[model samples]
Target chain A: MPEKPSVRAVLLGALPFLAMCFSVPLWDRIDPIVLGMPFNFFWLVLWIPLSSLCLWMAYRVDRHRR
Target chain B: MRSSLLPIGIISAIVLLGSGIGLLAGSRRKMDLEQWTVGGRGFGLILVWLLMAGEVYTTFSFLGASGWAYSRGAPALYILAYITLGYVVSFFILPPIWEMGRKFSLQTQSDFFETRYQSKALAALVSLSSVAFLIPYLEIQIAGLGIIAQISSFDRIGRAPAMIIAVALVAAFVFAGGIRAVAWVSILKDALMIFAALAVGIGVPYIYFGGIGPMFSALAHTRPAHLVMPGATANMGHAWYISTVLLTSLGFYMWPHTFAAAFTARSAAVLRRNAIVMPLYTLSLVFIFFTGFTALLVVPGLANGDLALFTLVRKAFPNWFLGLIGGAGALTAMVPAAILLLTAATLFAKNVYRPLFAPAMSESQIARLARAMVIVLGLLTLYFAIYSSTTLVSLLLLGYAGVTQFFPGIVLGLYSNRVTKSAVFAGLLTGLLTLCFLMFSNHDPFLGINAGFFALCLNFTVTFVLIRGQKKNRLLSIPTTPRSTPK
Candidate 1:
């Protein structure tokens, strides 16, 4: 039988969709607060690498745990 | 025209040449058919993540998402919404797939079906359906590459040359390296895509409105309808948004290439990690979404929103920056094109050539056959790209609907052991026939839902009924292979 779906899994899984939900509103707020860069530009550049970092960490956790 | 020629040629040369190096590097490695096809059945977390990212985020996401945002108004957000949900769906589905792959040493999705149902015929059907759908899909990527080259060159290069050159370069790497070459090149492609998307997402709003908040507020004032939920138009509505999310979420895992990555994971945990953080890729879309809004804000009479991104890039950036962005965008198309070509080649070799022509062929012989198929498939897509009138999005969706026909065979093979080999074959045949009928007839069964979504509906229904009857007849499933401990 499949194990119970965890809260962590659910949160991680839903993050992208949730981001889609709040993206416009998030853009509205972050747009003005950039460090001389456009918020959209800052957001993706920061988030993509950051996301890559998270995936890397998750990979580590899974590997170490195994 | 001559001035732009240098930029276009430079960009194309860099991507093509870099990928060529990667191809040589891959071929030089002591790799076999298994390694080339499934990365030696033990791809580490990073490589797996990069490869999966390469497969999922294509020129389609770049062009289709932004174009949807531009043309459909509010409903365009559904592109982001559905893709995010799709990864979430993958988290649950992939674990068992990984375990199954490990236990059986499965190389392809159809191999899984073949073993589970004990049916070579069902495996053949899945392979045939996948190759058929994937060819058109590969053509769409080639088409997208041609479009970017055309736009970036500012018409300095003709369309036919662009298509031929792009196809030839992709075939070169794919024929040389296989999965290793694709994975390495994808990292570069992803970086460029993220950078370019970030540039467009932020640059347009910042230059146009001083900031994003003010940008939206400006849009709100000019066309508040576009600003609000359900968007700025009467045609876009809540139903379309919700249904698109539903369709894409379920259909995401249906693609053969996505499953092809499963056989490569070093561990089941890698698959989970990929699913957990994959959503962050959606961050790239925020800018694409903003770019769509930028179209609404700045470009008037914008019937085509996809052009909004390229137009903004050409208008704002210097030649060097535009050249870099064009190279990056071209990489987005090229990386996927390599993978698709490789995958179609593998499918043809394993399912078609091996069974029909070389029944006693060794692994190396099969690998050689796969390489030959890749070259042939690449040429075919090049021909179609040059001659066909089909737009990128249309060709993509047509391929998608056809591929999604495999959903039933895939799902039942994993979840229920009771699905008979004959029952599974019948279901697949019926599903494929129904999908082809609806697609060719232009009769979308699920009110405004795409053809793929409609086919998934029929595929699941028939598969469910067939499995239920098989179970009643005591045609129980053979037990799945025991899960192996991760090395």
Candidate 2:
């Protein structure tokens, strides 16, 4: 519909998903607490905001293409 | 149980207030079947957000999330993983599905199948399975309500009566207001739930162990592995975690209610924008997990994992605050129950009944039958909620396994015209039969992968092979356009 979304846009859209699903090995550690939260829990909490940003960026790119 | 009357009274008042708001929303507008089912396709960004969030964060998430965190530990993170990925998947899938819905004036998820594949039998199959899957989902909400009422009232009221009262209230509001009622009530439910979660999650750790850091430190000192994956259990390792997450995320929008919610959006852009923002709602879930972790330290040795969150709240908070949280939890249960019954009833009436038994039925006749079915389904769910004793999370997972089988059918229909109608139908049946066989025989993790994942694989293979065979026959070649006209 919007000229097959750019590969860059598609990759940007998938960043959060890949980061959360595949990077389990990287962020599954419990050491080095961040702001009173466990490192593992903190990683998830951080991505909540970061994923929103990724989606927003993808949305912007798609909107511009349209 | 210190004279729980004050809190019980507060909870009753809150329930009444929510029902009153629901009833008032229905009074101003006249609803046809379309209006009743999807709000005449008039919802904008905010209403869609509240409705989507409302459906996603059910009572199961309210209590079961913390319950999983308290009991299973690291495996509980799967809840967060699946939900975020669900939004990511929605960004790619929902806009096209929403476009199809608008083009066909589709009211239910089953309607899409019927119109897309040009087969009534396929539509009926989808409708039947969706309704069957939705029953357990509804039962969990009804069960959650019973638990909240029992705990908040200090077991003075008992679970059955609490559930019956909830059933009556939900049935009444849904019969009067439909989707609009559910959406408006969600706004209030979302607000109250956020407040309650924040109060319990942050308040419990700070009050008991000085802060979140100390609480985790103490947990690590006592149960070091609890802070990591495989958690308190031995079986849920990396493989189990990845497969389960993938299965549930793919299955997220496959829920009939979630699929139907897309049709309510004002535009495709609204649906897309909502997908981007809906991940923020998972933040509330993080707070719920905090309370669950806190509960592990405060209320140890609970017989049932489902009771963990309530046990912690009753032990830690005052009567007034407990009542407030109970109110939030009750709304959480009721809101989603309303939407489930609405969607299931619509599927039965429009997709199953009208096409099979009463093809000549008028629009008003169908609407009347759907409303009646709502009451019937509500009563059936109430009976199961009172009688069944499974954990909420487990019940939800079983439902997910069944519904996720729809994934291949839906995706292929949207993107590929080469997939024959017969192949889609056969694929769904094969997937469902495999799922039932694996689950009933208690071989859920057959070959160390989730049964649902395996079932999906079998389903796709069958579909692919059948489609290739059909191409050789050259039998009624389907149009290769992205969207085809209805037969």
Candidate 3:
């Protein structure tokens, strides 16, 4: 059987959700359009790729730990 | 032929082709209950991903997200927030649940509850609640399919006939192909949905205002609040946003179809990988939102928010392109509707009817019964779809509030053993009752939080208190070898 994921990896996996959920106040603005998208839209769009990366890292760490 | 008929013809043709593909995919499979409902638990990563994506990006994401953007403004972003956070929750929750499913040969979500709690009453309650909420969910899809058909055909087909046709197609494919058919059809639907979303998302803005930036700039200049949350709405402030996101994220996998779909994964790792990747699918909604935001300017003052996407597409795109978008929209509704019917039928047959009434029913007998239930349930949802006049997004949120009540029981059963069956059962009942009372009484966002959030808090409190109380009782009741303690 594969080993359990480390506490560190599990916590790291949670970062994307924390960033998206609690950072709502920070990114709920319309200024500073990134690549022609509003900040509100850009924040979510940016997190799409970033979330995949975070989960990928989590997957790798969990797999490696196993 | 009229120009509008061109799009209608193309859309009808594509939908028929999709149904044919779905039927053919499951033609050779065995018709056992396991094979029918859970795809024999043999789906690989890609199939699992597609099946999940198919379920996640329903008609709601395609039309309702854009509709909300057009109508409610920034509050619609809660859809994006909940979906991504849902994946985050699933990453932790599903693997263990999948493990339990495989170990115990579980077929449905209620089976997990039944086996874990060792109580048929709990399982029965779960089965009934799932069916109750699922009706509304199925209604959303059926209603969406009807809307797509009527609008895309330029009223050539009326809503009732359109809903009837859509429901019949879903019922036929689900009856013939079961979960395998749903999975296969989802592949086609996902591809078309992505293509359609990209086309409308970018094409509309570019056509109307030269580009996406220009489109947003115009909206900002004219209706800036529409671009941010609590935008133009009074009650849907930050608190509503946070509570909604949290409630939906927690409740995401609680949908019986989503819960049952986890069993179809070939392994736990497949589920883990899917969870990691699924949030990326939310990117599709961004493009969908773009369509909605663009529509706010191009086609202002749509009476029904759900009509926003269709109105914008009809106005901006040509006949052929409109047909493609309509075809995509129809499949989005049909794919999820098939799964919902399948899951509801399985829950009724295996969990409710078999346990409560026909314990002696054989596997094949149950399978036959489930197939029949699919037809019955489909027709019933068709009736509700044609008759009920609730908004699509609110219908979904109502379902979420009810289903999320399953969370306390499921999570406790998964991670802890001390939670008594009575406790879990009471907690679920309380949560569900709270939701019904709040929703029916129009106390949504009661005390600055969504009704669902309050229901969940009450549920967790009841569960925690009961668990601790039970532990204390057990300790006190046990006679602890007092003489041996000295030794």
Candidate 4:
């Protein structure tokens, strides 16, 4: 049980990588501009905060175990 | 030449003002190894956040990021991708590094190796290679500043003289203040850099293309592929993007200055918190991309994409705004150059020189030698900048390729019990030699994948095989789990 939270934390941390990088092709096109940026550019910028939120959740999960 | 006075004068004034802040910050504490190197390891959350963020937002982000976006098209997205992932890796690794740093008074990246692996030879290898790699990195800053100064001055001030003046000013402050000075000056550099990036990011697009959407619309209409992967290149396609992102992110915290910056934080929690919020700083880079994309359309056929920002600014804005932007760009280079010189000097004097050459040297003597090495290194890189013709983006990639080889040793050694000093040493030598062979032989991005990534994988494999081939495990991991500190 002590290590269970870390597994969850690691999974949460991987979320951003999945969104921003691992799935580049799924959203790399310039079509469908969001907030005035091409989809490729917009996807990357959006994931930055999403990445933070993921890490924040990981921190919370790990902290609960601690 | 009358146009040069306003911008040049403004740039000079701001440079002096920043130098003044550095000198005053340096005055707060007496010179010591700890104070000069790691800000006495007392930086709180905000200072630590800026200190780490400041290094990431170097001339690379200011110029190289924009330049690649302009010239290389979608390949530059790798910069944004790698940085965001870099913090994800750091979130797990840096706190452990900081925790160990506090436990054993580890001051440099090489110290982490020396203490962790318990081998002086491995420490020396790490030090020598980091310093060697940092040369190109520091050169980019010096050359980037030189470019900013020369262009912003309307070329009346020659790149050589501009580089000399700016580096000498940087040397004056680093020579006076140490890490505290660098941290204090980060305040100024970050403020101006954020403003300048925002101004250009928004201004160029709005004035020309009516807004960010229209700018991209124009680009998409004109050159549709430029907004997609492998845009404007034979290679650097999706696979290259994926591999390079992996290489850069894994190797991000391995930079000597960055790894050592963790030591300056007061506690591990400070570092973890910093990581939580630092990715938000990458948002500013969105504006830089806007600026670069605008430059691509507005100033077509410009030979050097690195100068896209300056060329566009010079063309569109008034002279005073160029001067202010140039001043911001100058600081964008100097702050990182100061820290790079400091880190490389400390690595050489403390790790390589003391451990390999002068085992009997005291800490005070080593600190003094490190201080002297700062000037020597500053001049050496200045010489390289003046004579060399390497472009800004290539110079950054070259440095990343070499320093990144350290990634395997540092990261694997952090968690794995079987990783041995000898194996890491062997792997580092193999990695560096492979890197040199590949780079000099012009095989980088070999097979549509980053050559450095190839070498890194080989290095990791070598270490893993060696460790697995052996029968022993030393239980080298300091702690198998994060030690929870009370709030």
Candidate 5:
């Protein structure tokens, strides 16, 4: 049987948007550079893998529901 | 200036190699419509990954991406944001779409629309608009080809003639039944693209301003605003950035070609895992951004930003290295063009022509017409490329604004059967007209938000308001009734 995405999964989906989009203004400044890249640019790159991790966790949650 | 044979030579050789592998891979199978269109819907996870990766690394990413970084600065990172967002959204939509495709024996995206809403007319509207939007997209690939050839060959070869020959060559090979084999060629294209991007990304910055870190530090000292939102432009601030990201990410998979590519997967499980892993592809784009940044610092005043990468490569790298980069860029342009041409033509032949014009047309006739449409569409896009050589990024954004009008209908239809076909039809017409007005009237960033996003909001509102007014309420839309199109 099919099921809608769980709250946890949907919220987990939101984490990427939160980090990448919503929090953009907060991290938009290029100060205190991390790992040699600007804070602003580095912040988004940092989220790529983190977003995958979030989605993977979401997938697991989705699978458990199924 | 005299042209060099080396870059053109390398481009020709790689394109030939791509077509060769495309032919070899598909030589074993008969070229039926199903196989021609969706690779028999049998692509496993790895093949789907390659094909999806092919979809990602288009001429837009290859050249236009770096161009944006060169011109726009931090605003270019929206490309990075929206792609990851697309994969996030796809994880939910694709599995369901896949199940529907499997159950209905659906071949194209328009078929999905038709089956869902129980209306051939809706499907025809979809086919018409999607093909219309795809033309500008296909234009960039052809235009990108011309640009790469012109820059790499030192302008000895004009853009128009080069695009004509290259597209004709690819269409001929694809017409001969090598569509599926293009996946194998993608492996080469992706590898070379990554290599070119990394080599330039790391090498250019390092050569001029030390390392990547030092490069940014240098830029911060020289042009501080280029590292943040709005970047070089005053208007494209955080709000503009967020709106564009939302607009594009939602629209990414909505492109008819990308939607069809998702259908090529063997199973829903494959698609779920694909979404989990696909964000990794965006990391390669960061390197492309680095190349563009370095170009901004090193050679600051090229008339066209899209030429940044090619211009830098010509100045910095050896002749053969320039050839290698150009070859990879050529494949990046052509591979995606192959799929777009195929998708648009298939939509035209199967969904539009077969149903609306000739309801009694057989599958074989549809297949034959699709093949002929490929040649016609290729020439048509070539003409557009020659006529208006807009910046690659704007062409895509304009196209995105149009195709993304489908999102309300598709996503809503997935969750509920309550949306009436007339409502979606009305909503699409409204969204397209709003975009046309906003874009043409120079109000694209109306009140600092993306005009496309605004139109999308209006579309949703129209669709929802109209849905409430429908008397029939929820239609059963039973999945078991496959290939049953009620007139």
Candidate 6:
């Protein structure tokens, strides 16, 4: 096991968590320009890709580092 | 009321039949306490997922979500926010916990404390605090079961009897099968729940509003503006909403059963994979919130809005569909109730009973004590359920705030080796006391979100200050060195 959670892994892990966290605030700002979706809806949908990408990146980094 | 007897009886019978089967099936695995309490620490990934899913998705998701939507309008979306965010937060948190559990052979939260801090008193302190926090939490689940039973059976069974029956079935399965039974039952429970939630979430809107657009349009017309967005109401100010979300997200993993399940994961990879996929499962909750909102449009002037989901379903659907949903609701309540009562029992047995009263106790004896305590705790929850006057949403929020008190110890203790036991203890105590005072006082800002968040804030601050002052304690020993042999 790595002695510390990889910095890359931490960053990857933080992406979905932080995105979900700031979703309410972030959506409020972009709601005006972000098409027809409500900030909440945008928050939920944006998570789909971010979560997917984070998981993918997490895997790639773990494999590359190994 | 006179027309409701058969449905209530049928739900009771279904619950009993499921519990009985789970009991008998899991009995063989109950040879030792560790097996009974923690499933021999080798529960497969599928079982772990079911167990995790069961714990996360409870009556709160089913009934409480709808109730909030029906009564409070759009702010109920926070339920969806917290539940989904909780799992994602766990992805980063659980691997370290699982690795530590494997290395230390930890069984309970207290066990982890004991090993990490080398302090039995601290372990005992956590056990006591956890039990105090979790009993009410378990009681809420029991109370939830009672509410669902009443709703499903159309109130044929009164709250008191329903509580008794609910608690009895849970106790029987937990006493017989232990964690193995809870997990197996959770699979069926979760499947039925997802199916039922979707059936109601999708079916109701379609039947009542004809589709999603019409449903939203109806809500837009009727409900107040604050229900939709943060800035809409003074009650949902941006700072408070964001803070509430932060508090809940941080505290999500602090629930006792969550910790217990983390220790049972087959590998760290399984946990990360599970967290990634789990949020998608939250699509069911989108339906849940829709069900709540649709209830607002269809059923106006509800006296007890908590029953809005059931009220709307009964209004929109026929008897058989109601029966199907009723069964699903029972599954939702039972799966988590079983895990919770069992986890509480294990906490009491391993942390409190064995350590304080029976340090010489064998693993088998400890297992027996745990099983017995499950029954005792289950019955106690029944008593609370029967007596509880709190609304479903209030019960859930109160439980969240109570459970979140453990956040400081569990999360920060993992990554930061400098988190001294004294600092953690002081921090947790300060947070928990503040939370209790706030909970009892019913402080401002719309019951002003539970003390869990505020408590967490103080707890972290104290831990930080304490950690900084203790320079000698900052050696940062790796509790579970990566290359070290698993205990």
Pick the DockQ winner.
5
lDDT of 2 by residue, B1-487 (tens): 3989988998998888888888877778897898899989999999999999889999879988998999999889989888988898888788888878888889898988887788889988999989888988999898889889999989887989989998898888889889999999898899999899888888999989998889988887888798788899877777777788889899999999999999999998898799889999899898899888888888888877888888888988899888999999999999999999999888888888999899999999999999999999999998898888655446566679889999999988877767778898898899999988888787878777788988988999999999888755654443233343322
Q: Would candidate 6 be rated incorrect, acceptable, medium or high by CAPRI criteria?
A: acceptable
Worst window of 10 by summed lDDT in candidate 5 chain A:
A1-10
Compare candidates 3 and 6 on lDDT and give the better one.
3
lDDT of 4 by residue, A1-66 (tens): 012237788898888888877888899898798887888888898889999999899888788554
| lDDT rank order | 4, 2, 3, 5, 6, 1
| Per-residue lDDT of B188 in model 3 | 85
Per-residue lDDT for B157-228 in model 1, tens only?
677887788778788887777788888888888888899889888887888887766776666567655543
What is the alpha-carbon interface RMSD for each candidate? 6.2, 3.1, 7.3, 3.9, 4.1, 3.8
Per-residue CA lDDT of model 6 for B348-423, tens digit only, reads: 9888988888899987778778877887887777766776765543545666776676777777677676678888
Better of 4 and 5 by DockQ: 5
Rank candidates by DockQ, best first: 5, 4, 2, 3, 6, 1
TM-score of each: 0.86, 0.96, 0.95, 0.96, 0.95, 0.91
Evaluate residue B223 in candidate 2 and report its C-alpha lDDT on the 0 to 100 scale: 81
Q: Candidate 4 lDDT, tens digit per residue, B1-487?
A: 4568999999999899988999899886788898899888899999998788778899889988898899989889989889999999988988878877887898999998888888888888888888878888999899899889999999888999989988888888888899888888889989999999899999999999889888998999999888898988888898899889988998888899999999999987788789899999988888888888899899988888899989999998999999999999999999999999999999999998887778999989999999899899999999999997765446567678778899888877766656788789878888888887887788987888889989988888888888887765553444335534433
Taking chain A of candidate 6, what TM-score results? 0.66
**lDDT string, candidate 3, B77-109, tens digits:** 888878987887887788878878888889999
Candidate 2 chain B, poorest ten consecutive residues by summed lDDT: B478-487
Q: What is the interface RMSD of candidate 4, in Å?
A: 3.9
List candidate 5 segments past 4 Å from native.
B1-3, B389-395, B472-487
All predictions: root-mean-square deviation over Cα?
4.7, 2.6, 4.1, 2.6, 3.3, 3.4
> Model 6 clash pairs?
B33-B367, B74-B227
TM-score of 6: 0.91
The true-versus-predicted C-alpha distance at residue B245 of model 1, in Å, is 1.5
Quote the lDDT for B322 in model 1.
75
Better candidate by TM-score, 1 or 2: 2
CAPRI-style class, candidate 3: acceptable
Taking the candidates one at a time, how many backbone clashes does each contain? 4, 0, 0, 0, 0, 2
